[model samples]
Target: MDAWEPRPVPSVTPETEPFWSAAADGRLLVRECPDCGLVYHYPSALCPDCFADAEWREASGAGTVYSFAVQRHLGYWPEDDLPVVFAYVELKEGPRMVTNVVGCRPEDVEVGIPVEARFVPTDEGGIGVPVFVPTEP
Candidate 1:
């Protein structure tokens, strides 16, 4: 088995600095268009819906698993970290974002399962990466 490599840290740009800064504090943020009222992720300068400048808003950190895939083998991941669950989580605010489902076994995840956001700090202590875990019953 190969050594575990650290996950890539997201690059911070002028437009995304606030988003990353908030993430470092364990807060999840989404971009909202003041014009069209569209809320979305992957912070960008302009809204995809109306091209209007988007503003940052804190999210509720609650969501549901929309779809997922269990990876049993990936060259970059350590052997012990097998079966990573990658999923698309639909935030209660109404936008879908790609994220990972953690804190549980891969087989334990399924579509439509309620989830909540959890932040994992980067190895270098940079911005926290937002991931989801199943909500308690």
Candidate 2:
């Protein structure tokens, strides 16, 4: 069996380019809509609520764990490490994201646990992806 290796590169696409760019630069982004005052994640150009074009801006990086589940299988990405905790982190700005819970044990994750976005630098010490971890009070 091969040892699980963590991601050493950042993944950015047109739709989520802003987010990745910001995270790489030590900032967290949350979607905000000028059309209807709605904020969301897994960013969309159009507001999910008002269907208006949205904008990405820096977030407080402060949120709470709303829900979570421990993933035991890789499905397609078989190289994914086991006991991966998938969580819904609800930001104080009124948006939530489906992301992984890092910096702790999967079995220790709990609902309503405070969390914040923490960047994982790439192989060459460049900015990488944003992962969540338990936040301190």
Candidate 3:
């Protein structure tokens, strides 16, 4: 999707309502478990652990690239398309989130490469999507 274009976010069930609402404000929100201080994505209303209700809050979005790979051949991603930098960012607070690495060329990504959140406005139907771009050098 074009960074400048807003498209509808295809899914928004009752459970995920709060997440979309926060994203609309240009905030990157994550679920935090009060019981264990755990944070995660794929928004959930309840903490999987301790059955504690989840709290919605802003995320620092600062993290490091845990691991990645260069796709030698893939039709889904165009030949000239930006390289996909999939990462599992381990938050300083305790949650590790799965997300794509953007803003930098794929070759620049490496294990432990530091990154911070830069939210992009996106629409997945009616739900707002908070896509991340790497912090500028």
Best TM-score goes to which candidate? 1
Candidate 2, position 137, lDDT: 67
Question: How much does candidate 1 score in TM-score?
Answer: 0.90
* Segments in model 1 whose C-alpha atoms lie over 4 Å from true places: 1-5
TM-score of each: 0.90, 0.80, 0.74
lDDT of 3 by residue, 1-137 (tens): 45424323437788887777666666667888888777777688888876799888788767666666665565565455545566777655556767667777877777776777655455444445554455544
Higher-ranked by lDDT: 1 or 2: 1
Ranking by TM-score: 1, 2, 3
Q: Kindly indicate the candidate among 2 and 3 with the higher lDDT.
A: 2
Tens-digit lDDT string for candidate 1 (1-137): 11113655777888888877777688999999999999998899799988999889999999999999999988876567788999999999988999889889998999999999887776544467788889975
Best by lDDT: 1
Where does candidate 2 have its weakest 10-residue lDDT segment? 1-10
1-137 in candidate 2: lDDT tens per residue?
12213533545568877777677677888888998898888777889888998988789988899999988876643454666888888988878888888778887799998998887555533344677889776
Per-model tally of clashing residue pairs: 0, 0, 8
